[model samples]
Every structure is written in structure tokens, then in C-alpha cells.
Target: MAAHRARRWSLGGFVLLVSTAVVAAFAFLTTGPSADRADAATTALTWSDEFNGPAGSAPDPGKWTLESGGSGNGNHELQYYRDSRDNAALDGDGNLVITARKNTDTGLRCWYGPCQYTSARLNTARTFTQAYGHFEARVKVPRGQGMWPAFWMLGDDLGTAGWPSSGEIDIMENVGYEPGVVHGTVHGPGYSGGGGIGASYTLPGGAAFADGFHVFAVDWSPEKITWSVDGATYQTRTPADLGGKKWVYDHPFFLILNLAVGGDWPGSPNAGTAFPQTMTIDYVRVSASGGSSGNGGATRTGAVKGIGGMCVDVAGASTADRTPIQLHDCTGVDAQKWTLGGDGTVRALGKCLDVRGASTTDGTPVQLYTCNGTKAQQWAYTSARDLTNIGADKCLDTKGGSSADGTPLQIRTCTGAAHQKWTLA
Candidate 1:
């Protein structure tokens, strides 16, 4: 990800930190309607890093390879990348904090100039690499001049093909100058650096990204990649979208995270720039898209009619986190459409029908949440025609057992009542 002193700009659904410990950190996602259109739980949890260790601890050495150097990355960045705990460590608050601090030692120098700052760069080069999948990170970025933080990937064959020929996929790149805008770009032999093909997504309502943690993700398939922020897809790029350029993203690629200062894209830091700037990463996860393979179970879709003929609906056709999944008049709309996946998940609006907070207590209202392949989202069809969430062994019941239209739904003990009986057809 290269940058020039450019003008300030302005730019996934796969358990958006819904765990009880971190739900509030992601409350901003439930503010508006979402447009998640995932067909099923196609992506399987292939790898992840929850950073659930004590404060000042190092990251999982088995999964991450710390990179240290002041090579400037060929961009004249001022940070001398360090592999120590001072630069990267767990915050004991369920986060991995990567700090960039002022380095006063004038003796430390880079190939281009003196290193005035020190930061961290981490990669999964030796441990994890996949050809295609949904890659994501929940990150709260820091703001100030010359701060360039990125979550990106490079072809696994980097040692052989080198630089542009090896290919690069920048899932998320943010420059402090443009706090509200993030970028997604692909670099290849013919189009690298400034000429790379990609686009920028600006947060709505002039919201600065440094305000909170937001999910940055990319759904990578064989022929295309779709970028989304907080489950809303903003841009998509495919081989056809390349405009005749080479599409070098056909093979495996590994992940990388780094914080750099004083790059070509974002100029040097000014007086207002703060030292000890930190980027907090909630988690990094990858899910492999369950392609056209007829494996998990035949993907089935239809209306799930329950008591009083009310159909289960995702509120307002929204797929956002915490959106209510209630019983409503059957309109046969997309929001009312439901799918039963082989993975034992009942999906709607590209999200799974989840018991709120995985609560097993009676009357716990159900909601639409990102499909995290958790038992809380899994539903099994019983011989009694009742849909039981495997996680809690509770039936999908109509609230109050009422037959009235627009009645809400919740999880209750499987009493085999008429209200719990559902027909998927």
C-alpha cells in the first residue's frame, strides 16, 4: 500500500464481535439497516486470533511471524519496524495493541534516512495462506499525521515471483490524513502502487474511523473480491473489473498488519501528531466460502410460517447485527425468505437466526446476527416439525404463544405446542 501526500478522502458479515465481552464495542453496527446477502454459512471458520491473553503478552508465535527492520518498505517510511512487546502486545482487554512511538535514538537509521519512530509489522507468511476466503479484522484505528495502518496480503509465492509479479491484495488501508476513508486495492505486475486498481469507501455521516472499532472485510472467491465495512458491501472487483489488466489473485496469499509513519502517501507527522499512537485490533478471522460444493447439505429456501400464519421476518429486510427476527404477516419478501443450510443454520437476510446472547432462558428473543458457525445459530429440524436451536435445545417459539399478527418470536422449552410447529415451504 503506497501513498503520496494526496488530498484527504473519504471511505462483512461473518459474529461481529458479538461475544458478550465485546458487544458494546460493536454497538455502532446495529444503528442502521444492513445489506448482507450471504446465501448460507458458506464460509467455514478456517483460522482466527481472538487475542485473549493478558496485557503486555506477545501475539501467538505459532500463527504470526514478527518482522523487524527499517528497510523503509521502498516507500521511505520512517518507522523502524520492531518485533518486540513494546511495539505489539495484548492489551488484556481482548485486544492486540500495535503501538507506534517516537524513537529518540539518533543512531538508529534506515536505508533512506534516520528512523524517528518504531512500530510493529506482523504476518502469517509461514503459517497460514489460503487461495480464497472471507478475510476480516475488527480494528479501531488511531488518528494523526503520517500514520498508515494496513491489513493486507501478498501472494504466498513472494519468494519466487517477487514484488508486483507475486500479487498483492490490500483488504484495508487507512492513512491518518483521511480518517474517514479506507481503501481496498489489488496490485499486480502491470498495475502496482499508485496505478493499482481499487476504490475508497468513506464512512457515512462524516464519521471518523478513529471513533470506534469497525469491521473491514473482503469476500474473496475464485474470480472476484467484494469489500464491505460493517457488513455493507461498498465495492466489488473481479477479473472483468480489472479492465484488461492481469488478475494475479488466483493463488494462495498470506496476511500482514503493520503501522508505518512518514510514507509517500501520507506525509510526515506534524506537531499535532501524538506519540505512542496505537491501533487496537479486536480480532482477525477468516472463513472459507463454501463454494458450489454440495457438501454441508442441500441449500433449501422458503417461508417459515408459524402461529397465526405469520412468517418469520428479518426486520425491515435488514441484515444488521441485533436486528429483530420476528413474526410478521407473510409478504413473501426477501426478508421473509429463509434458508436451511446443511450446517444446521436457519438463515435470512444473509445472517443467521441467533438466540440473543446465546441465552437459553425462556422468552429470550431471537435476532439476526453474523453467521459465526456457533451452536447459538444452529437449528435442527425435529420430527415434530419444530425447529430447535441445537445450542440451547430450545424450540423456536412464538412469544406468548399468541396467534396474533406481528407477534414476536423467542426461544422457549420444546413443549411441542402449535405455536412452535413451523412449516418450511
Candidate 2:
């Protein structure tokens, strides 16, 4: 983690409190589409760690690199991370237990003299990285003030891009003081440190997360990322939510797990804080979209309805290159049957939905062309119901927002208007 990572602040009274416009943007960014969990459940398992090692054994070295130091991980945390089974070990019962204890004998020197606590931090930076998919972990967090546990990720380009430019995704983070809530956040340039974009999910009826294991996850794709707790989605973020800032999560990233004591965000553990608190992890898994590996899954075939409940039809059902795509009545014909494919192509009449001339200009006609794995043909049907061209970063729209039959489709700046909203089956 970098110096500006995961250091959130209270918007109400903190020195980092953002302006009113930013606050309003935050509110809008956190709002997500409904039925997100149902959509996420369809992914196929791709990678996982069950922690089935012998009791008291170290985690599989091939899968994890135990980070050791008193650097505090740029959070001004108190704990000295030790790469020892005393701090992290697999219990006989199929769980990885990370224990944070009051330090006494080790005498590890931290930035502020001797360290007061010892814990563990582990990452998969050396073994694995994935671009887009579903990442999840089942965890029972530790309680008491000053305890911070998280399952998160950093972009693989960290060495080159650096910090926020490399991007970060915090799937789940919990501070002991907020026993009933956990947060999911994304850090990028202009939105690092206390300004990271995210939202919190709280358990119902004031239930404490430490009371039982809960599944925390993120369904991520090129266009959007949805965060969930126990299969219930709380937030979904997209490039449109970035307020013109860059979206840096399109590349592969590696995972990390850590427990820190007394950080700047959580403050130093008080007299009431207990030592030797343990965070138990049952499993961590990753799945690919559409029940298949790679960018997405099996092709989904159906009518892609747009404004006025019209289907996106291939003009004249022609397989010829450069055929225009238009809006027409929903007739269930092959011309109206579009295939949302694994390679991010929208296909009908055996051709791909492409931005004409590979242009990024507004009002560029969206035509059907021979499928070529080019950015011009890539599309992401976002949770906001906008069919966005990956190359243009624009939405599919009917010309002049008209609903008349044979109205040609084009790529334009996304405005969340009715004409840009699509319903893909």
C-alpha cells in the first residue's frame, strides 16, 4: 500500500472534508442498480484459496508473500508486521487466522520508537493478477477500537504508474469502532487518501459483523464495479461517476490482506481496546464473468431494447460489412436478436456493433462490421443501462433521441437520457 492508501476521513469535521459539489457527486456515485447480486451469481469460479493447511502451519508460500516490517504500510499504523506463524496461521478448521497482539518481547522499532503491537500482512503480488471478474472473501473480523482489517487489491502497474495512478480497489475494510459496517472503495489519481470514492454497507438491526462470517465481494468489469456484502449489493461505480477523472481499473491487479492496529483513521487503541484480536478468513475466491474465463462468458442472445421499447435491429438483416444498425419494432427476428459476446462485442447478422471509422467523435454512426478484436468494436452494457463503446467512452443513442422506425444509432456523450438507456437480455 502507498502512503495515500485507505486513509478515509469523516466528511463532517475532518480537514479533508470535500466541497459540497464533491459531496453530492459522492452521493450519486454510491447509488447502484438493483438486482446486482443476481447478476453476479452467474460467474464461474476461476481461482480460490480454502486455507486447508495443517493447524499452526504457514500459508502456502506459492500463493502468498508475507510482508514483514514496522513501516506501518503508509497508514501511520502501530503494528509491526511479522512474517511468522505466530501472527498468521491456518487453524485445523479450514481457516486462516490473523492475530494482532500487544507487543512486548520482539522490541521491533517503529517510526515512533518501539512498536506497541504486532500483526501480519499478506499479498499475492508475486503469484497472481487478473483484469476483470468477481473477487470475494468470507471473513469474520476482529472487534475493539483501533483494529483495522481489509481485503483489497492494487494494480499490477504499481512499479510504473505509482500509487493512485496504478489504482486500488478496497473490496472490504473494517475498523473496530464500526462493528456493524464495512466499506468498499477505489483509489485513483485525484481521488486518493481521504478522497477515495466509496460507500459503506451496514448490517441490519445493528448487527455486528464480528458476530459471524460474511461474504464480501466485488463484481468488476471494464465499465463498472459493484460491491456487495453477503450477496447484497450496496454500490456500483463507473467511469461516469469519476467527475471527469481517469478510470484506472481496466488492467490486472493483485490481492492483499492485512490487519493493522492503531492507524490514523482508527486512532490508537484505548484502554478499553483488547489485545490479541484475531480476524478469521474462511476462504477467498475469484470468478470470471458469464461463467467462463477471460473477459466474459458464453454469448447471451436476445433482443436489445432501447428507447420507446424498440429493438436494436440490423438494417435489412444483412451480413455485409458496414451495414447500418437501426431501431425497429420488437419482432423477435434475427435482425433484432443481438448476441452479447464474451469478447465484448455486440453481434447481430454475424457482424459486430462498431463505431464507424473507429472514430471517437460524437454522432459517429454505429454500424455492423466484421468482428475484429479492436477497441472500436468493444462495448460494455453498464449497470446504468447505457451501452457504451469502449473506444469512444460514449453511449449508444438513437439519432435526435427519436423513436421512429429505421432511426440510425450513433455514439454520443453519455447523458443518461432515455435514448441512451438499453435493456439487454
Candidate 3:
């Protein structure tokens, strides 16, 4: 009856969706001339569904609609989706839950149930649609074989030209089999469904995307489609490479959130895959132009020492002045300014050291003394590619010990020092 019944979430605000895990991952996937990047157009507030308000309801009718049936257009998938309380619901925990449980929808249920799988498919098919805008969400995935969860967009004129011609933008897609990996794909003419060409990546340390919730986003603009996880970018796509496929990017399109099962891509549920799987959506948000500036102005790479949370005044110096170490905000100030000579040299206050003088001691104030060329400043980034000063062991560090207004700059030691530890790109 009502629209957008919501719930409680950990993402802090009603806009930002939250996931239940911690991965501290950063890296973008696409941007620049990609279909996703064509988001700099159309209605300002357009449409959005965080599925966050109350419970037992469809999304805001002002924004989205529901798509049902087997052989969904093409993907050759199985589930019989619907716009009902049983399929989609606004769980009290601040989530728009589109559960893919193992239930039966009687004859209406496709594939037959206790249809091996039962879930909902939510989309903004007709009605409100925009040409381009930043599409992002915070979500936690369900773990199970044959499970297909996706956050994507499609052309508003689907009834006319149909898929590939109508262009489909898959901002994020992941199978239950590959938990830590994500796929960013585009479908049109030569690149739709089975022939769709896209790339995938496995985040560092074998990160688990299903570990709770992670922010999955796509910066859609005219130039490119940049895919990012937890604010970190990873891949990109462009139009030229689209082999004659219909470019629906120029027209208005809406977003869709669904948990598909046993499709042409994910195949069938395997042993590891579980039942009653749910793709918890913390929020599905749409913002007018000005998509998030990569990591909100976090420099691509800079002097390490003294870098702290969101360029905050660290050590009595102004934020814009000295080389406050660039660190993961809210974690601690110990990971700011670090060296880049290939030796992990984190610098601070004219010194290059990280974390308690690298003495493995606690609370040891990082000093800007000198570069002893010790292991303290010799940090090695795994799977990270960048040019560092492998010779002098000098680091890109902060000079002053002030978190106040503008402070001076320079490089120093390798202590587990609070002022050292820098972000190298």
C-alpha cells in the first residue's frame, strides 16, 4: 500500500547504505567515457531506494517498479519474481532486504517450488528515469552457490529496441561462488548476456565481499564508468569498444536490485552455496551530478608522514600546510606520511619511521629525527605498483609536529611513529 518502507542501518545516514563486514579496501574500477560515467545528466533528485524506512512494503512508487517471470527477457534465469510482501520487505534493521530464500509461490512461482529458490526483483522499469547520475550503495551479500546479486541500470526504452540496443549498465555483479571478486559489465549488441564483455578483480588479502557489507558504487558520467569498492577504484569501460551495440547511455535509465538464481552466468547452486540467501541492501542512492570526487579529495599519492583522517590538523599544524600523514580516517594517526623509495619509509616531522619507532612498542611518539635507513621506514607494498626512492631511503613525509594550522614539511624516520606511516597511492 505505502512506498519505501525502511529499516535501521549501520551506514550512519539514511543515504549511505551499510554492509556488515570490514575490509578497509580502496580502489576504483571504472570512470572516464564509460556508460556508467554518462551520469552527468537529467533530473536532479530523480529516484532512489535505500529500502530503509519501515517494513513490509514495495519501494517508493515515485521511484521504482517490479519485474517478474522466468526467462527474464533473456538471461534465461529461473525465479518468478513479484511485487509482494513475501518476496520483498523492509526489515526493521534498516535494510531493503530482497531475500532469495527457498520457498514456494504456488503455480505463480516459476521453476516450481518450494521452487528451489525464492526471491524478489526490484527495478525502476517505467516512470522516473534519468540520463546520468552517480549510482552507489552499501550492501552485504548472501553466500550460496548459483546466487546472482546485481546493482545495475537499463535503458528506459527497453520495450522498443530491447536489450543490448537499449544498453544495460551493470555497475556491480557478483556470484555466490566468488565472494571476494566483483564484476563490472555492459551489455549491448555484441556485449549482452552470454557475450557480454567485462572484467573482474580479487581484492587484496583475499578479501571477502560477503563479510558483512561493503560500499559498491559506480561513478557514471559521459566519459567513463568507474567501479569502486569501499571507495577504492578498480576497473573501467568505454563506448568505442562497444562493437555496434545499441548505446542506451544517451537516454534515461533506472536502477534495479535483485537476487537472481541459476542464471546463464552463475549456472546452478553448488555444494558450498546455501539456501535462504539474502542480499541485504543498506541503501540504494542516487545523487545529482558531481559524483563523489575520488575518495572525497584524498590525494592519489603524497608525502606520507603526518597524514591523518580527512586532512585533519594533526600535530599542532594546519591541515593544508604540513605533510600530515594520509591515513585511514578514524583508525589512528599512526599511518600518515610514509616513504616511497620501495622500502616502506614512512616519514614525519623531518623523520622517517612508523609505529613506535618500529620497536613494536606501543604509544611511542614518532619522531622526525633522521633516516637511519632502518627497517622502520622500509615499507613494501604487496601487489601495489609505484616508483619509490629505493636509494637514499628518503620518504615523502611531514615536516612539522603540529596538527594545528599550516605546518612546515620534510621527511625523517621509520619508527612505528604516529607521524610516519603514509599512503602511497
> Which pairs of residues have clashing backbones in candidate 1?
3-264, 3-265, 4-264, 4-265, 10-202, 11-181, 11-201, 11-202, 12-231, 42-290
Candidate lDDT values, in order: 0.74, 0.77, 0.51
Model 2 residue 38 CA deviation (Å) reads: 19
TM-score of each: 0.61, 0.61, 0.55
Provide C-alpha RMSD values for all models, in order: 13.5, 15.6, 18.2
List model 3 lDDT by residue over 276-383, tens digit each. Answer: 778888887654453334211111223332345233223432222222332233333322432222123433322343333344332233333233445544443322
Off by over 4 Å in 1: 1-41, 292-425
Per-model tally of clashing residue pairs: 10, 0, 124
For model 1, the run of ten residues with the poorest summed lDDT: 23-32
lDDT-based ranking, best first? 2, 1, 3
Worst 10 residues of 2 by lDDT: 21-30
Stretches > 4 Å off in candidate 2:
1-42, 291-425
- How much lDDT does candidate 1 score? 0.74
